[model samples]
Target: RLIQRAKRFWPAFVVAGLANALFGLLDAGFVMLLEPLVSKGLVGRDPETLARAPVFVIVIVALRGVAAFVSGYTMAWIGQKVVAEFRCQVFSKLLRLPAEFFDRESSGNLLAKITYNADKIARTSSSALTILLRESAFLISGLIYMLYTNWRLTLFFFISFPAIAAVVRVATRRFKKASHNMQDAMGTMTALGSESLQGYQTIRIFGAEAQAEENFKKTVERFRRKFMSMIATQNLSTPLIQLLAATGLALVLYVSLSELQSGRLTEGEFIAMVSLMMASLRPLKQLSSVNSQLSEGLVAAQSLFDILDEPEERDSGTVDLPTLSGEVVMENVTYCYGENSPALIDVSFSVKPGQLVAIVGPSGAGKSTLLNLLMRFYHPTKGRILLDGHDLESLTLSCIRRNMSLVSQTVTLFNDTIRNNVCFGLKEVPSDEKIIEVLKQAHAWHFVKELPGQLDAMVGEGGSNLSGGQRQRLAIARALLHNTPILLLDEATSALDTESERHIQAALDALMTDRTTFVVAHRLSTIQHADMILVLEGGRLVEQGTHQSLLAKGGVYSRLYRLQFGEPQLGTTTS
Candidate 1:
């Protein structure tokens, strides 16, 4: 299958193969030069021919050198091409895979496929291929020369053939098994390393460094064991096969000596024959070593192919969704994660355009899952959701998502300038003046302007250089710039201080005036003025009504509010 795929680059493969073969054939032809030098030049006293031998040797060596260069350079080029192409395919597949797929798989494993496994393919394409083609040519040429010199003696050399074949067959299976184990171990090691680095602060705080170190050491030891196992197999088999072939060479040499004693072979033929056979041993040993590279490449290829074969997210919708008025409706919706109990069950709700619907719930009460459904990240397992009276499933995923902007609790900022982070994924990128106005609206421009580079300052990875409040404010700024019809804020202001939260709430109030907004909040103070609040508990809507009304009822929302504020001051809507 890999070779068939490589046929796409047939021109390069052909050039590299032919050059490698010519190099080996030239080497074999070089050995035959000795026959003439011994018989014709020395014995026959051909002074004229002997005089030109240096030039002949120089020309053959020069052509062989050129062939080696062309072969090595071109094969390396093909290897690089293979790595680039496979990485691109894997990367594209990652972008299209469903969110559930990402949730279940570790990121480190995916990364290894693109980096380490793809590199194995390169080694196979270049060095492994070079050895296979070039050595076979050299070995075949030597075998032919041996036959021409003394067919009877060459017949004895074939006695060790089955043993060499059997050894290679056993070694190949072991090599492949070791390669698979090594690749999987490498992925686990990568995952462990990434986790330790990313969670370094927590590790230090908890003083669990020893535990982390112990776990990493175990994984490293596993990887090393598999590596050494492969090496031991390769080393043991190479010499054993060499010894077997040497036995055949010994048998052939004994026969040749007897033939020489009987005057059946010339002195020049014997010398040329010995040199070619000795030369043949080198390529044969190298060929045995090629199995390791080929095995690794094969295992890596299967790993990459598995990723490529996974089905992409199902996007069967074709209908166009017009600019939404943000009226969202869910009827008997149910969702479950894998085989677990449904997160949201038979839930139904409707909110008109421009309504600030706050979904308040306990930790596992499925508040975030509601927002996830709204964003079309995961389809409801058993029910339908509609936006502006249009069934969400009938609309393209892009169309459904384009009308909403999300600011989740965990902010994600790129390692780029603040301006780029603020305007991320906006179809119509706002100008500097507009961006500043949006940042000012979200109350983030104050800190941004005080920074060294202001709007152009680098955020660093995940906005690590910024404070938690500043990151939240920047995310709000980005959502404001998005300027979509429907806004989803999952604890968007959770990181802000009381004073900062007040300021951001004022900004959000202004931004939410004409758009439909959903706020999933635990802070009862923030949602006091929400036009309608849906109180969810145990994945069911236990209560739903205006904030003042729900508070007056003294139900779940009322209890939650009193728990935070210590009392429900119902008449005045104050944060």
Candidate 2:
């Protein structure tokens, strides 16, 4: 991981190293100028080229300054490129991930991994790589100059280096652990915010605003504490390194002064060595700081790699059904949401082309689960679902869903113009007239045309700006515009009032004319004319027939019908 990350900025690292080395060499050369300035030149005794010595040093310094400027900008550009590539890769991975992966992971937390964590990895990796390369190069060049000037004094400085390494190692391990905790807390905070925002209406309706705020505050506080702790752990390394540097400098200065006094070291040589020692400040500081930054980067890289490494969606051996007749069949399917609680068991049914089928049952009777399986949102645990004459598992998901349209209970609208929402499922740009035609057919045109901007008004997020019935009607209009052969309606009319339901049901009746339709309906009256009315109880198909045929038999469907529309004391089922 480290090597690959470094390679991402290889060009920058290489350029920074060369530039830093040139600066270090010039630093040593400038110190050599100090010798002449103090001795022969400082006395103002020469009238020759010695008068121009300071000008030569100034030119060298300017060149070194320009090199440093180029190095910094080059590294910054590399960092931005690396982050951009990482974000794009994560987005591509999201498209390839299986649908079940989204069910198990929160969208907000996954978004953080793609955006937040990728940036952290890029910033830390690039900064650390830049620091490591430039400083290591400067430190090496500075040390070579020091040794050539006086190897004995340089050797004295190395004695305290082991202590520096030991302190940095301990600090970095804590930093990495704390950083991981901080990132986990961030994901939790994001999840809380996302869930709350999505369900803001429910929170307000229940008057649990305070409770939701308190819950969000708790997550924010936990994340704050974790982040502060990580920052403290990283900060500890700086002071520890400073202590090591102070101790090392004291020893080196004492030994060098004694050498100078004994005539073993020239005055010019002693000053040069001291200058080189001062140059160690940035490199030595960076040597300690790099470990902590690199640890944080590794923590982020581990998170990013964890996401990228997940198993992607497979299209193996899957072929298109050419064209579907919209005959759906579920054969003895068993499905469980968890290991212990079954959602559906041994459920079987079939719907022929252009038939209208209504699946009615009590809540939690696998009504939605059956639709979910047909949509391939979750694969069944046992048996198979067939589209046309081919098994659903044998066809590509895109191929199967292309022939189907779904208008669900919970309507979703993008913050876009009404025309786009109505034609969302089309692979190509749809004609404006076609969208308006469907809107008229769905009985949505009356309100839409009255709006200030017909078909062009922006629907707020999830259509929150529209009334419930209006949103439902728009959803129906969208389905009608798609014009697929199959339609799945899951409580699509539950939000509508009696008058609105009557108006929209007529439109739905027209839309379902020659389409194979499956309706998960709670109001039995709406589905009385279905070609097949299946009564589901406890995940089993209890009764199956047209409404009139089931009423004649006087079974579960008859009991439910009487319970819904009959007098309480009539005992209609027993009669």
Candidate 3:
């Protein structure tokens, strides 16, 4: 996959590889020049050759510098582009993944993939590639030069090469294992840090600072140990390889010196051979370290590829409804989450084009799950939902959601101006007058006007700067502005005070005059006037009737209503 992504940047990598090879070739030329300069200038006392030698060295150095610049710059550019593309692909995939995927994964791990793993891939593509290409080229070139000078000594030097290769082979496996561990540890640390930061207030309020600190320290310690293990393997391989190379160099020197004394090899040739042999050592050492870098990058790439390969939310529907009449029907629907037990079972209901339907249930009664199915965040495991007489599965997900607006208890507001949050994703940006009108209708205009910047005032992350009621009102205002034919209110007024709830409810009443509305609330008072009431318990619709009729029946709804609002029986009589 990495290679597939890199195809577009192949030209840059090819240019970099050629330039790096030129750098290696220049090293061989420098080594060859060193012999004549030393012999002719120092021993034979040739002044003209010595003077020209400096100019020759200067030209080689200048060309090598140019080659180095091109290699470095081009590789870095390719690395950055690769990192950017990987990040974009990962983020886009995250957005398209099924809701179940998020339910089973952590946001922090996803974030680490984007920030940490992507960077590791960049380093591998850039610096690692540079070293692998340049050093391997330099090593091969140096070997050729040494062979030209004297093949016998070059053969002796290569005797230790197999030992170095064995060391690298053994360490490569350890490096990959340690690198994978370290990446997982990094994700754990990021998750811990994210939780601590987001819940700082909870930590302080509960006086669990010590516990939070200990947990974080433990996470960091694990990460540190894994990181050290990776470093240990990488560092150990280099010196061991270098030691073997040094032993080979010593053996080669022992043989070469005897050849020199016997007059079989010229002093210039012997010196040149030694220079080229030594030149190979630096590249050899770099190549040893490059293995670990490449391993780390491969591990990161594998982690990211796993996410990218996950199947996206199934969207096979080809029908697009430009508008919906707001009528909704569910026919014997059943749904489950993963291998867990069913969430909704054989449930059935219907809503007229503009009727208000209230779904009241206790916690864990599938209220939110039902809303999720309606929004097509998840498909029903069995049966089907129909919108305006068309099967929801046959309609495009966007088309299904386009006619609906949702206001839940937990309102999502980005850290941006109130105007932008209210008008978010509107086909045409609404006029200031239109924005204020919706705010007024939702009873949010009063507080918004009191702010220093009015509609332009910035809301902190998740609208933290706003009070609960204020945030709820802003959410209601947003839904109002959407002006869709369907409205989903999941405890929308749960955050508001009685007075605020009354005002917002009035606004909602006017807004629902021509739109289908679904209200999921545990607060019975708010939905008492709903056009139809569906009572649920343990994933079953236990009761369905008007508020007054259910109260008269004295069934599950009556008992629940009595529990919340009916008069308490006297205990004194029994005493």
Candidate 4:
């Protein structure tokens, strides 16, 4: 895939490479010409020619330098363009992926691919590609010049080229191995940083700050060691190539001198031959070095492709129902987070419009699981869920989500102004009056208006600037802004204090006026007014009825109510 993607920039790359080759050929011609001019003017005592050699060499060097510069700059520009396009494509794919993909992967790992792995390709494209073009062109031009000078000597030097290639091949393997370790270590460090920041409150509450820091430091140190090791391996390729070049240069001079002394070659031709041989070997050695870096670059490219090739959301594209009535039916739904470990079992329920139903369960019961199913984060192992009598799978996932609003136990907000967080999903810019009304309905407007910047006040990362109750209010406000007919509240008030819960409950009471709501409640008192209360245990619905009827029956619901809210009154049958 990377190769196919890279082909998009091939035209520019080829042009830049050819420019570099032409420059190398010009440089070699000028250098070879010098040998003759030097021999004719100095050895043969031609003073006029000797004076002109310096001037001619200067002009050739300047022109060739300009060509090399243009070639390098153009290649870098092409590389940047290709990398930009590649990154944009990757980001687009990420956004288009289904919610289930996020459940199975870490945000930190994917983030490393985007920020670090993509940067690696960019660096490789700019510098490694420039080296590849310049060295390849120099090597080719140098080889042609050497063969033209003396085929016999060129063959002798060429014999060692394979040996240098072997050394480079071995060294590059080590560099690639080290590069993998380095990238993995860097990912580990990134994960640790992300975890620490995301769980800062947990670490602080548990007084594990020191341990967290130490863990983070360990990952950083491992990354440092791995990258330094890769650098060491990459650097060794250069000196190793130079050693081979020096050995070959020594052999060539010895053989050429012997040939000249035997009258098999003229002094001027031998001088030119020696100059051409140096030019060829020099570039070949540089190319050997570049070969190692480029090989490591391919390793990074492979890592990038590993992410880009991930399976995306599999939509059949058969139907795209945009709106849904507030009616949901769950028929014999069975689900498990892992194989053989049930989370929901043969669960069946129905919610009609304007009905407030609460799902009450123990800690391990499948209250949240039911909500996840309705949202299509995970499909059921058996049975189906229908929205307004239409199968959820038959409709586009985005279309289903647009008509529903979910307020989970944990509130998620970005580091943005208060108004933006409240009006998150509105494609068109929402009027300030609408945002203010929603905030007021969610009981968030009073405190928000009290703040210095009011609606424009910046919420810190994940709304860190707000209190827990304030954050929950903001999240409720977000749901109100969405104004979907179907509302899923999964322990939305479970984490709040009593006062905050009361405040939020009042807000929720107002918001639930006409919506079909599914409430996952842990606190029994919260669901006393619910039209229907279903009790779950071991992934199965044990008892379901109105709070008063369940109390009369004296079943599991009554048992839970007594345990949580203390014993209930007699004759309080179905409200």
Backbone clashes, each candidate:
0, 0, 0, 0
lDDT of 2 at 560: 88
Reference-based lDDT, each prediction: 0.91, 0.81, 0.90, 0.80
Of 1 and 2, the candidate ahead on TM-score is 1
Top-TM-score structure, candidate number: 3
* lDDT (Cα, tens digit) per residue for candidate 2, span 1-575: 54574585677777866776666566556766665565455555565547688688789889879867776677677777777777787789888887778878988888778777777877675677667766776677778877887889888877778988888778877888887988888888888998999898999999999999999999999989988887786677777777777677778899988888888777767776776677676677876677767777788878878878888876552777656778989899988875757678888888999999999989888899888888887788999998887888889977877888999998988999898889886878688888888888888898999877988998898887789899999999999988889999999999888987888899899988888999999899899999998788887778899999998887888888887986442343553
TM-score of each: 0.95, 0.90, 0.96, 0.91
TM-score order of candidates, best first?
A: 3, 1, 4, 2
Candidate 4, 209-309: lDDT as tens digits: 99998998899899999888877776777677777876777787878877788877677777777676666656765676566567656776787676578
In the predicted model 4, the residue pairs found to clash are: none
Cα RMSD of all models vs. native, in order, equals 3.0, 3.1, 2.0, 3.6
Model 3 — TM-score against the truth?
A: 0.96
Candidate 2 ranges with C-alpha deviation above 4 Å: 1-65, 204-207, 569-575
Superposed model 1: Cα runs more than 4 Å off: 43-45, 567-575
lDDT of 3 by residue, 412-501 (tens): 999999999999868898999999999999999999998879999998999999998899899999999999999999999999989988
Q: Assess the local accuracy of residue 527 in candidate 4 as a C-alpha lDDT between 0 and 100.
A: 86
lDDT per residue as tens, model 1, 1-575: 67877888899989999999999999898898888888888878899779979999999999999999999999999999887988998899999998899988899888887899999999999999999999999889888988988898888887898999999999999999999999999999998998899899999999999999999999999999999999999999999988998898899888898898988788888888888877878887999999999999999999999999998987888877667888999999999988999999899988999999999989999999999888888899998999888888888888877889999999999999999999999767778999999999988888999999899999999999999999999999999998899999999999999888888999999999989999999988788888889999999888999988997797898889887877645555756
